[model samples]
Each structure stands twice: as structure tokens, then as C-alpha cells.
Target: MKLKKLVLTGAAGRLGSYLREPLSKLCDELVSTDINDVGNLYEGETFIKADLANFDDMMGVIEGAEMVVHMGAIVDEAPFEELLGPNFVGSYNVWEAAHKHGVRRVIYGSSIHAVGMYPKNEFINTEVAHRPDTFYGLAKCFTEDLGRMYWEKRGLESVHMRILSAAQVNNPRALGSWLSYDDLIQLVTRCIDTPVTGFAVIYGVSNNDRAPVDNAKAAFLGYRPKDNAEDFAADVLAEADVLDPHDPGHMCHGGPFASVELGNSGLAGMNVIDDRKKS
Candidate 1:
């Protein structure tokens, strides 16, 4: 199925920047929205400065779009109060707007933190129950439920892509949970073009040798990730210090996020440099 008009939230985000060009190749028109003004625009793309929390503005902007790619939210792990408005309410506005506007499918950016409380050694599939590690993870859990409810009750086809990690290989943990930008684009493309989809929850992990999750559901979505993080293994491994398994950073649901003091730089502590921008 050809997706004609597409609405992409979080258009100014790290991953969204990478998706701008590739998404345009598939759709006749790409309506990219974000709270910030994304200066440079691409061919066949329209950048609209809009917030995901504002229901009226969001619905107005997404009126004519046939599909919605919901990506706008506070990315870092934060206090519950900080996550309520943007991550929680914002997700609700997106789905309600899509349903009200008669959009067919919603491609969501789910996270590993939704099930972060599970032990790293225990291999998780999409079927596992949610055990949110932080406020950020709790928000992800909420949206996944929202997506499922909307699909089962309202007849909206939804795909929750449980992205394990979408960043550069920084340390030892990332080697086992990396989701490269190219592979991400491939995953989103398949989610959009798949002929028939109900409520599908699939892992966004790449073909990593040390991957924590088993993506046995690959046949369901036909997502064949060609990249791996083994090339960075030696360097990342050597750079990372051996940690105490009992430490919350190692033991808690969100690793660093679960260990870091609230309101601290949880993302910064992870040492992720999201340099997905162009020169």
C-alpha cells in the first residue's frame, strides 16, 4: 500500500532528522511537525511548528494526513511531574487526533524502558508485560496501552516499535542494545508499507551479536536489520568499567536512569551523543 500523505511528529528530533529525506521518497507529501522551528526543509516536505500536547493545533495540522508517525515527547528520563504533560498528555492528543481525523495507522516509538525492570539476562519478547523503570518508561507504557485500546476499540491499525536503543555505540550496554539510524529508517518504512497490520508490538533491535532481546517476530514484520555494533565492541568494552551487578544503574529497570538522582542529567550520564544532524 502506498502511503500518500504522512504526518510525522518530533520532526526536529535526532531520529526524525534522519527520517526526513527517506520518508519523502515514499510519500507524495510529508508534513513534519515539532515544537521547535526546524529551519532547513527538504523537497516534498512541509515543516510545521506545532506541539503534540495542543489537541486543537495538532488535529488541525493532521486533518488531511492518511497516517501518523507519533514521535514527539520528552526523550530523557525525568521526574513524573515533568513527564506528565509532554510524554503522557501529548501522546493522548496525538492518538485522539489521529482517530478523530480518520487516519488508518499510527507508527509509535516505544522503548525498552517499558519493560526495563526485567533482568537483562532474561530475554524479552513483545508479549512480555510492562514493568516501567522510570517516569519516561511509564509514559511509554501508557502510550502502548493507548495504541492497543485505540486499535482494538476504535479500529485503528497500530504498530508499537519497541525500540531497544536508538543511539551510537557508547558503552558495553549499548553494544547489546543499539538501533542504528539506517536500521530505524528501514523499520519505520516496513511499518508504513505493510499490507495488513493489527495491533503489532515488535522489537527495534538490530542484528547485534550481543543483543539482549530475541527478535523472533521478524517474520511478522519482515524487518531485516543489516547493521551490527560488533565493530565498536572492543573499543566500547575497553572504555567501559566493570560495574557491580547490585548497583541500581545495573540492577534497576532503566539502568542509569533508575540510578541517577531525579532531575539530574539521566541522558547525559548515558554518554549518548545524538549527532544525527547534517553538515
Candidate 2:
């Protein structure tokens, strides 16, 4: 059944922009909210300026929605104070508001950094305990547990997608961790349309031959990703010189995030392009 109303947080963000058009087509009304204005929306989409950390504002944005696509948060490592409002408290507000408003489900854009400290050589699954490499990753761990508690207690459903990486494949890490935009949309769609997903945690990765994480436990969600980083492997590997295997940034599942000091910038050493379309 098509959703009557769907609310998407972080509407002005990179991934959020990619989701706007596709999600707008899946519902009668698509309410997109963010801290900044997302000008000139699609046909069925409407934008709302809201703050994620403010409980009342989050409540207002999510009220009456059947499901919420929560993509709002600080997407990198930072001081606890900087992340406190947007990444930590913001998540709390989103979940609490969803509970109060009786939203059926929340499709969270979680990150693999939640368990990022694990070695790249070790293949882990959703059931693995979190080994966060930074405060940003810690926030993901907190929210995943939050979702589980809510589902077990309040009957609200949620899907925590532990995304390895979502970017244009350009580097060696991306060759194993990249999740194409098309695959991301399909993953979100499967999470939304699945009949009975009870607080499930799924890895948001394509079928990369060198993928470090396992998604076998989440098979019930029916998310069969169609993209593979191997498509770009030749170019990426050719341009990439030998990496220091001793470096956690190259040897850990978190990539650059694993090597950075706490409260440091994870994007500092990596090369990723911003591909969000201009509105």
C-alpha cells in the first residue's frame, strides 16, 4: 500500500536530495524537513524548516506521517558538545516524537562506524556488539539501541541501515564499501515496503566482491542490492598506489573514520566529491 504521508528529515543533505524525488513518488504527500531551506522541490514534495534537536520542532515535523526517513545528523567525528545536539539529542527527539505521533516505522540512515573499530579482515554481522571509533559512531550505536528498546516496548518498528559507505566509488576502500545511489534508494524502499521488519539492522552495502560486512542475517528484509563496486574496480585500483596495511584507516572497517583521533575530521584524508544536484 502506498503511504498516505511520509516525512523525511535532513531534506537538504546530500543523500536526502537523492531520496526526495523517489520517495515523493511513493506517497500521497512527501514532507521534507531540514535545518536549511530546500528550495524548489519535486511535484509531490513540500519543504519545512525545522530543528532536529528541538523536541517540539521534531514533533511538529513528524506528526501525522506514516513513516519517517531519518537522515538528519552530523555525519562525522566531532567534539561531544558539537555532536550532543544534532547527532545525539537530535536522534532522541526523532524517536520520542515518532513514538508520540504513532508513526509506524522509522528508516534510519545508520553508519558502519557504529562497529568501526573492528579489523577490516574480520567480517562481522548486525548482531556484533558495537565498537565505535568516535563520538559520531557512538551516536549510531546509541540510536540503534534506542530503536530496539522502542520496538520491544512501544511496538514501533525501525530499520537501522549500517551503511559502510555511500559515495561515488573513487578509492580502494570504496571499492569494498561503496553503496551506489540507485542501490541506496532500493535499500530504503525495501525497508519501507517490507511487511514485518521488527527493529532489524541491515548493512547498507552493495554486492561488492570484497565487502567486509555480512548482510546474511538481514535476508528477511528482501533487500537485494543491484550495484557493485567492482564496476569501478579497475580504474580505482589502477590509480590507487600501495596502502599502508598497518594504518587503521586502511585496515579497519571504518576506513578514514577509524584512524582519526576523537573530535577530529574523518574526511580530512579521504577524497570524496559532493554530487548533490543544485536546487
Candidate 3:
């Protein structure tokens, strides 16, 4: 089940850093790339500095790779003009280069913000129409369609992992949306090892009692998450703020993203911890 080469974009990022060690073991050579250098490397891993917005850079990084984990991007919401190169063009470059190089599949880090406008009470599935909360979410929607088109038109495979909350479970919303790091690794592993996923979409969420999204349609991928944010519910809820019933930030699936102004930072209000994995 090992690949000859696996490319991981955003290797210097928080989630990417956590993945480097595991992904390195999944392949003979793990080619990790990012705009900045990853300070250290794991066994069977090598780092390459590359910008996602540049097609030539992406092509060179992806060449000879069996699978690509496309995680590089300006993670927070920003002006469409500012995000145009990194988020929009970057995804296009990855898909196009993977297509040109005959790569097997792309496992993308899609987000819940892609359908952030949906009410938190209403459980949505992968097939729901896009209701992006920000330009960042819009970019996710765009890449998802891009992945679908690539699979249908060129026979390239893709797995769009609509990650909910891959952060610390510090708030009430996270009790339903959290995707723990261990679960994140498992989700990506399933995407890579699944035998024949032509074009699939899966919600990257843990087995929480209050999970807001359904992954039944993507059962073929065999991603069964283990952690539950409910473990942190007692402490988090004891110090929780009273809910504003009228606020979309509390009522919508996007959480803070659903209420943030366009081009504003959604992470700013989230109080997400800086927990990037160290080499």
C-alpha cells in the first residue's frame, strides 16, 4: 500500500507539519513543499520551497508523485484580490499539473465554510449545494468543482475532505465540529488507501455525539473517526458564553465564518491555539 512518491503541499503549515511524519512512512519519498522551508524533515521526507500560485513551481513539485495532498493556501478569509493567486490559482495549478503528470488522485483540504450558511441544527451531507460563508469558502467551492471536473473530464481521481474544525475543542461549537489531529491523520490515510475513489466528498469530522454533518455517502472510503470533542465538553461548557440565538455565528454551520465580514479574519475570533507539530 506504499506509494513511490507522495507530494504534500503546505508542509510548513500547522496541519501539514503533523502529517509529514506519517505521510513520509506511506511513501518511499515524501516531497514536502511550501512557500517557506520546513525547518526539519522526517525520515524518507524532503522539503522544497515552492509557491502554490506559481504553475511552474507546482508542476516541478508534483512531478513523479503518485498522490498529492493539496493543503497549501491562505487559510483565513481575505480580500478576493489578495486570495486570487494563492487560493484560486493555486488549486487550479495543482489540478492541472496533476493531470499533466498523470498523477493518481488529489486529496484536498476542503472546509465546512463551503456550506457555512446552513443552520447548525440541520445536518447536511456532501451533496448539498454550496453556501459559502466567505471568499475563503468560495475558493473551497471552486476547488471542489475543479476536482469534480478533473475527475469526470480527464479521469483523474480526487477526494474533497470538507474539514469542519481541525482545532482545539475549546468552545461549544467545536463539540460538534472538531476534527482531532489523530482523526485528521486517519481521514487522510483513508483517502490515500481507498482502492477506487473516482471523485468523492467526505466530511472530516470526529465521531462526536453532536456531529453536524453526515459522511454516510462517503462510507466506501472507510473513514471512521475515533475521537470525540464531547470529552472536553464539561470544562468548555462550564466557562462557555451564553449563546446569542439570533447570531449566525452561533446558529450557522460556519460558526465564526458565517458572521465575519467579507475579507475579514474568521480565525481572529476563534481563539484557535498555535499547535503546529514540531519535527
Scored against the true structure, residue 65 in model 3 reaches a CA lDDT of: 96
Residue range 95-114, candidate 3, lDDT tens digits: 99999999999999999999
C-alpha lDDT (0 to 100) for residue 253 of candidate 2: 93
| Every candidate's lDDT | 0.84, 0.92, 0.94
TM-score list, all predictions: 0.95, 0.98, 0.99
TM-score top scorer: 3
**Candidate 3 backbone clash number:** 0
Please, what are the lDDT tens digits per residue for candidate 2 over residues 1-279?
Answer: 799999999889889989999999899999999998888889888888999999999999898999999999988899999999988899889999999999999999999999999999999988899999899999999999999999999999999999888988989999889888999899999888998898999999998999998899668878888888999989999999899999999999999999999999897778878898565
Each candidate: RMSD to true structure? 1.5, 0.9, 0.6
In candidate 3, stretches whose alpha carbon ends up further than 4 angstroms from where it belongs are none
lDDT of 1 by residue, 231-273 (tens): 8999987888888898776755466876776656568778778
**Candidate 2 colliding pairs:** none
